[model samples]
Target: MEFGNDCKLIVGVDYGTTSTGVSYALTGSSQCNEVISIQKWPPNCPGLKVPSLVACAGSPGRSLWGFEVRPGMKSFAWTKLLLDPTFNCDSFKVEIREVAGALGILKLPEDRDAEEVVTEFLRHVHQHVCGELKRFLFDTMSPGRVPIEFWMTFPATWSEAVQSKLKRAASEAGFGDKVFTVSEPEAAALAVFRISKDFELNVGDGVLICDCGGGTVDVTSCFITDMNERGVPYFEQLTEETGSNCGGINVDCNLYRLLVTKLGEDFKNLSTTMVGPGSNFMKEFEYIKRDFNGELPYTLTLLGPVPREITLSPGDLRGIFDPVLDRILSLILSQIKRLMQSLERVLSTSKIIFVDGFAGSPYLQIQLKSALRQQMAEVGVLVAPTPERMVACGATVKGLQGIVAQHTNAVDIMA
Candidate 1:
């Protein structure tokens, strides 16, 4: 547990609409190939990430965030989307209305805006990450003494304005003077290529990455150019990255709509009886959605006034999932088509890599695999291991590369 004088720490934060993840690497002269994900989080949330949620009812300095914001608490979620100016447009009316309604019900402080909420949330995340780093590095070295670099991942299609807003928020949250940004799809590609042993890529091989997350689905095509002396692969973009707001949240919204339709008159009791942050119904539906695979019926028991049990049959789940799944598949297919046109040849050895939280859905994997098999029998689709942590881990890898390159250049200069 020793380090050289040139040792540095790299932290990567993946702040999603629904959750956030952190990964870091400690590097020196040798190549740092291993990125450690911060699995332990506040309030004992047992996962690689914590919900991107914040409760601002109390003082701003004492605001509760992540797992600390529990059910029934008046909290803010999806504030990340508000950073985008286009989020208010007709295309995002559904999501925009959802957020507006939640804010209205919560009656958040008039002075606190989306940027402020996001900054506060990230501040908590930064503090927790620092504590974890200090504990992990214990007596070996002081994190404060090392040159720590912070890298954050953003959607590939986010506008420059949105990116700037995110960077500003991160900086205010103590991510340092200069917070680096990595496109989500590129980060996913980096992690998948670095860690995945399921498939090997040769020079000139194409990889299409489909990142299905809580707020957005992004697709990117990368061509493997070469491998470095240390066995790290290099990639070149084959086509423009494509993405849309059609993601897992859309399915949740669909379920909400279905519940409202089914419950009819009784849906009005959800406010006083059910919990905030989209109600207990949505929370229960999340587990059902993740475990669903188009074969069994999932039953949800409502606890509000006039309690009732609702059964979601296979067909009902399909109806809720198909629209969003179709949109994601279209994105992947479009990327494939564009990649083929750019290469002007067949994609015989190419593979499709799925990453991000939504990629863990069994139904999504089954449908994507089935569709790809039908269209391109030779092409293979594989889910990146620990799909949820890919972006954050990949961001760490990118940071590690930067540190190594700088160390190598300094050595050459000294020589």
Candidate 2:
């Protein structure tokens, strides 16, 4: 926390496609990456993430965001992904449009576009975060505006159009001129460096970071050069960023489609219509998908369904997961290969770290490690302990490295 006296606080917001997470820390303190994460919202809900969803009974001002919306509420899912002006709907296996239609949430006035929905959602986030800061950090401050800097994260795979749209939405949502943007993988890497006890970067060391979110997976390989005077680590790009649309949502989509095919249209309509909290198929899949390692074979049983229980064997589950897993593997292998060919000398010490909630799956980490270690035995794979907060915290860390590091250097020079 070698921050400057000029700044009062630094905030990071990971506005993801599936879930949004926020993290903040005071600047100019000696608190080594000590961050406060916005896990629970009003009414005391559990979990460090909030669903990236928004619903309006009428006007955008009346929208309900995140955990505030009930399951039966007419809300939109994956609204952030929808913001991509160039998104190819045909390639996306899951039809978000159809899902919206099925849920009947797209009725007039409430039928808002991606940007509109996101703006409303972030507005709520801004309000909540500001209130929390006021209560905890600024309670004793004099009657004046507190100086705060904001960092928002986005995928490296996104085009400038997508990134600009995000920035615009944030601006509309009340983010001030102090706000800045960072790529998901970059933010995640700094975050890892901060939290990882064994993490150390030397002049020749290499590290690969894979940030797998709901809608996209971004991979970056960094070649560590040297630390700043203040002992802050810095990295140079080793390979071009690799990314894929294959993420946890695709797995969920495939599983859902498979279930629909097996259970028929009747069940499809019924479940999507009245999917109770954590009792539906996708919810059930989430609870177990991370644990399943294709070990001893697997079967996902549809829970809370009336009249009959539906069961899917390991073969079926694998069939659903194979395509998405293949895409992810391809990205990982591509980056590893690129780095190994280029940094053959330090390849032995290189490590791959997966951040973001989707990549937190033990099954995925095991599969990746098994596949990767076979090729490079000395390499290691570690999943971020708190996948949900890694991106947000990483964004915060990015600000620290850039702003605070520079300020500390200037201060030392003056002293």
Candidate 3:
């Protein structure tokens, strides 16, 4: 379970579109066996994440990151979408621009085609990560004693060019030759497999991952190929994998439009136009999003522009979520069915695990459980622990292999 980890560290960064999250573990410490997501950051919060936001406070070199930017300070979000060379600026124009306009940022036209913004945001991430790591090491171990390496996560559906740009961004952020990349879906799968204390997986048992994130829903299935000497599940890919842009963010957008239409432009001007993905109304709406059972209707109260509230019945929530949820469920269920058919065990039970923030929605989890049970009793579904931090946690766990390799190579050279 140990990497040749003396005087070394392993770090993983989940540079998500909505939030950036990180975790660091000493190569030799028991932490190597338990991936710990960094819980502290500037102006400290109790959460394991910070908004993936950046703002131009001055020229190219000066910027504000995360919660550093004050309200109306022209910060940019969804910056990670820039890495997707094929991502349509036009397709996302309204939502992006609304926030940009709200913040008074004017570079949307100029920065749309470049990687500088993404790099700058990641630079902040890297700097903060180093600071946190240094503080921890300074207290328990000597500073400058342990060499650090990074594992960054990206969308499984991202193009190679997009991934290359991400790597370049990491390097520009000062990671140098110490960066590695793992697909978000794979990282999520790894995190779930590594953390599940109960061993329900026997050799040949299949696990399907529905990494339902902010802007994309990726589905990948891997079968248990073998177990490590420690009896950990070893995976082999069983499907081509697929995804779509219909994630939580899309539902957020749909809800946003509905609000604007119902509440009017004045309310829009005063309230968060983005909804729950870091929106002003998130405090009130996020609860509804999580708690609204398909059985009963719900109400959301917003005291903005004027004190006001609105009701969205169970039917209403379904109307907003069904379109997006249907797309995700189809992708996940199809993959499971395909796997079942391929394995020629159509009637036999299989494991399907859901991870990432969207999977935490009780309403969504219920729908998944019911759908799978009804569609086929052979499929068992469970949401992994720390669903919100799946990518970062998984990357942290998987990065140990690289640390061990580097340490061994250094040993070889000395020998």
Candidate 4:
């Protein structure tokens, strides 16, 4: 693969706990505005992201990943959480226990560690991304003809050790030596800042980023420092990121428990017979969870031996969601308090809260807006235009910024 000196390709990979997304831009073109997300994935997964799952249950030395890994297969899920050493802390005890139980029941091969599993999954992602690049750029130039720089995003709360491990995994997965890393919240912020036209951001104004994903929710606050002539906002971190295990998966778990309580003995059979990936029960519930906005009642039908209809009223949905929502709310408020302390003043009316990630639920957004309105009436809560792809897109923006900085530095040196 010969690199072309005149052109370069920048790729961003957002590897979340439940799914992953990819975005890329050709540096020879415009900056962040021209960034494109890779939406085509194998096995016909219809989304901007693919499942972060890998299965090698039956075939040795051959792994199936993403949409290729079908339900009912013994696949590795949520392996991204394994990279965090603090995942076992008291706050995440329930999540840790759940992961352990799933691993034990699935009986994944003992030979592979979490890093290796993640590497395998990422390898598949890299391959698919490369294939897409080739397909798209074939008419102009081979992707190999140009240098490729890869950027990956991780949870903001992750430690240096976890970041290093994730970087190593990405490198091993064929991202090459040019693998760069960015915090998820920062990346999401960049994405929102680049495309946000409605908000008026001035110097020193505070912006809070809430990234709610499948397995965790991370909150970060930053203060705008400068803006370029193009209206791109630049900000500096104002506080250490705070996060928790309360995410969309927890909602699913809550719903499962609710069903068990509601159905009693009937749940036992339903759980054993129909509860798994690709199952109708899981699919229907996922749709309900994604589209539910606090006013709708959802009816879930169970098939197989214990066929029955369970209607979840608005109140029941609220019961399942409020606990998780409350946790996220606490995280945001804590960050806000910290920001206020740092600034040594009350939060200004110009403050903006940007929310992204797959679990940035519609109901969650509504709750955030309502709650923040009551607490800080002038503060606004805005959701990213492409919540699921925000991190990946922001990563490309970061990469583009790096390229621009390098070019400027080279010119300065020559001058």
Best by TM-score: 1
What clash count goes with each model? 0, 0, 1, 0
Give the Cα RMSD of candidate 3. 4.6
Q: After superposition, how far is residue 285 of candidate 4 from its true place, in Å?
A: 1.4
RMSD of each: 4.6, 5.5, 4.6, 5.0
Model 1 agreement with the true structure over 1-415: per-residue lDDT tens digits: 5567777778889999888999988777343556889998888767898888888865666889887876677678878878787876737555445533522232335778788888999999998888777765664443335557888899987888899999899988887777888899988888988864566767777788888999899889987888877555688887888899988878866666666677665664466226345456666777887798889999987777567789989988899899899888888887777777777666543788899999998998998899888988988789988899999998998887764333211111111
Better of 3 and 4 by lDDT: 4
lDDT (CA) per prediction: 0.78, 0.70, 0.70, 0.74
Model 4 scores what on Cα lDDT? 0.74
Off by over 4 Å in 2: 1-5, 30-33, 93-111, 138-144, 199-203, 227-232, 275-281, 296-307, 340-349, 403-415
Poorest 10 consecutive residues by lDDT, candidate 1:
406-415
Flag regions of model 4 displaced more than 4 Å.
1-6, 30-33, 57-61, 95-108, 140-144, 269-273, 344-349, 403-415
User: How much is the lDDT of residue 284 in candidate 2?
Assistant: 59
Worst 10 residues of 4 by lDDT: 406-415
Cα displacement (Å) at residue 222, model 4 = 1.9
Give per-residue lDDT, candidate 3, residue 219: 83
Model 3 residue 36 CA deviation (Å) reads: 1.1
